[model samples]
Target: MHRITGSHQVQFLDALHRDHVEVEDRVRTNKAMGLARLPSKSWRVNKGWVLTCNLAADLDAWLRLLTLHDDQELARAEPETMRLRIYHLPARLACHARRRLVRIERTWPWAQAFTTSWARLTALPALT
Candidate 1:
């Protein structure tokens, strides 16, 4: 029911279709993050559940896009693998003076990447 374009239309549609496919892939990831089922009877609670899932998704994206952006292996890892390698990786928490210190195990396989990414993340200017 719409007008047709020239040969450039095929290129534009190809790019658009690729983006749509990527979005569908992300939809599957969001489901993995707990968006698959809203397990609450109350509407308010369901909203909160969605919000929490979005927060998790945002953090996952940040870890990939910012922390491991330049790292080939880690960047290509799935969300579950990423969580296992980075977030759930064992670390000793210590309180010193007025602050806390997270001391990751120096023997871990990805310890160097973890420390390098941590340093880069912290070196960012304060969020005013």
Candidate 2:
């Protein structure tokens, strides 16, 4: 089984710090979806770790649409940047999102929205 050591945890902490700096710089540069910080914590679950911001904003939009509510306001808004804020999220959240996406696809039959939302949520690191 995989175990997380202090050093491995530090790497993620460092990434969060770096991301804060980058986000601040982006804000100065007038960039949209500038940056946000995720909460920090220690846990021993799923043989790994996860850290991320709650994507309540995006989820709200989806829920609104599903309910035939006023999604117009949400439509004009840009996509959530929570994924970019956190370098990693717990494996459980990832799995949960994946499962939620599957359910959404089954009920909505709109694969494009689900695919785009999943991609946005997963926002893995870019290759150098």
Candidate 3:
């Protein structure tokens, strides 16, 4: 869309191309998440739906980066893979000794991955 020059020419071009690719990837992801449909006839209602969809996508992205970044397969996984493996896996939350704990089937294939990711997420510095 614009010219690139000076000391930052290659850097700018690389960034621009990467951003374009990322946008395309996000568009596909959004479609997979049902963002292609307008939930209501009214523009106002549709606007709200769009906001909700975008928020859900953003939250999914954060969860993937924060929770599952350690595993190579998971780190590159799309939202659908994440949903099946991590989000929809059943777990029970309980409070014990004033601390909340999540209990899951010990035999679950990804239980360890889930717990490790959870611990890493909790240990991260709070975002400002």
lDDT leader: 1
lDDT of 1 by residue, 22-128 (tens): 89878877888889999889999999999999899888888778878889988867777777788786888899998999888888998888887898788878989
Q: Which ten residues in a row have the lowest lDDT in candidate 2?
A: 45-54
Residue 7 displacement in candidate 3 (angstroms): 15
Q: For model 2, how does the per-residue alpha-carbon lDDT over 16-125 read when each residue is reduced to its tens digit?
A: 78999866653432222222432234344311322111234334445434432333433333344223212122223234644642333233333344445456555645
Decoy 2 TM-score against native = 0.20
Question: What would the per-residue lDDT of candidate 3 be over residues 1-128, giving only the tens digit for each residue?
Answer: 45534536787778889999999998877876668998889999988888888888887788778877778988778878877778787888899999998889887887887888888888999879
Off by over 4 Å in 3: 1-18, 95-99
Candidate achieving the largest TM-score: 1
Off by over 4 Å in 1: 1-4, 7-9, 97-99
**TM-score list, all predictions:** 0.83, 0.20, 0.75
TM-score of 3: 0.75
Winner on lDDT (2 vs 3): 3
Ranking, lDDT, top scorer first: 1, 3, 2
Ranking by TM-score: 1, 3, 2
